[model samples]
Target: MIQLLFILLMIQIAFILILSFANPLRKLVVKGLDLLKQGRGPLVTKTVAATMCVVLSSTVYTITKIQKRSKDAGIVNPTDEVLMARRLLEAAFLGFSLFLGLVIDRQHYYIREINLLRKNMETAKKTKSQRLLKEMSGN
Candidate 1:
């Protein structure tokens, strides 16, 4: 499970890096994201995120319970110590994955907005130039 979460976190980080730059690949990535958000894509993504959140909460609960047990016993068993450490690592990875996912989503959204603005600006410039040409010719 930790390995899986680590892989997911790495993928998210890579996606964020890809989205941070203006390059040919960035356009492809943005297009892919656009398609991913269509139809059932959003529902699946939200479901997965919600499931991860639940698992994270459960891990936290387990960690707290382990700590309480150790406190009550006045000593931490070696096995409990190892288990707590593992759980903490898992929680950290899960949290980072979720955060990076949100960052990637936002980056994709902004990139799309920037692209739209560029298109609108180009269109406006063309129209303005056309108007200037008509006025000059008429005069």
Candidate 2:
């Protein structure tokens, strides 16, 4: 579980880095993301995210239960201490991965919007230039 979470976090970080720059790879990554958002891709992504949330919740619940038991006994056993630490690590990784996923999504969306606006601006410039040339020649 720890390994999986670590790998996911790394992948998300790399993806964000790729999206942060203006490069050929960024275009490719954005195009790939566009395809991923189409069809059943979104459904699968949401399902996986939901599953991670459920698991994270369960880990937190377990940690609380362990803490309560220790408080009632007035002492923490070694086994319970180790288990609690592991659960905490898992929760932290899960939370971070989820948050980064959201950030990546938002960044991708804004990049797409920026590209669209740039295209529109260029088209308008060209049209205006053509109209000015016609007016100047007619006058």
Candidate 3:
């Protein structure tokens, strides 16, 4: 369990590092979530679903390879400790993927909803302006 938690912590740190960078991936994840909250197009919302997968797989592979290289290494996961850690990583990645998929599915719908809200706000502003103009003219 501790090992799994450590793995998760490492993965979380990597994610944080990625987010801290001023890169396209960071923008995509942050901006995508924003658009999603604004009810933008689901298609436009490219959630980082694939990201966790690629990261987790590569990380697990590297870790496993490292463990295999040491001849002094006793039995790896012989008592399910490593297996449990693997399961934790797997669960975290799988759950993240599903959640992103669901959220991104509404990407297009969100876009349309945001557009409608903008249109409404603009119309309201124009109507208020026209009303003010009429009042001034009458005075």
Whose lDDT is greatest here?
Answer: 2
Candidate 2 per-residue C-alpha lDDT over 74-134 given as tens digits, one digit per residue, 9 for 90 to 100: 9889999999999999999999999999999999999999999999999999999999999
Off by over 4 Å in 2: none
- Writing each residue's lDDT as its tens digit, candidate 3 over 50-114 gives 65556667667755665664434665445455655665566565555455455444543454476
| Candidate 3 or 1, higher lDDT | 1
Model 3 residue 69 CA deviation (Å) reads 27
lDDT of 2 at 131: 100
On residues 1-139, what C-alpha lDDT tens digit does candidate 1 reach at each position? 9999988988888889999987778988998999999999999999999999999999999999999999999987999999999999999999998999999999999989999999999999999999999999999
lDDT against the true structure, per candidate, is 0.94, 0.97, 0.59
Q: List the residue pairs that clash in candidate 2.
A: none
- The clash numbers for all candidates, in the given order, read 0, 0, 11
State the lDDT at 118 in candidate 2: 98
Root-mean-square deviation of Cα positions for candidate 2 versus the true structure, in angstroms: 0.7
Off by over 4 Å in 1: none
Candidate 1: residue 89 Cα off by (Å)? 0.6
TM-score, candidate number 1: 0.98
Query: If both were scored by lDDT, which would come out higher, candidate 1 or candidate 2?
Result: 2
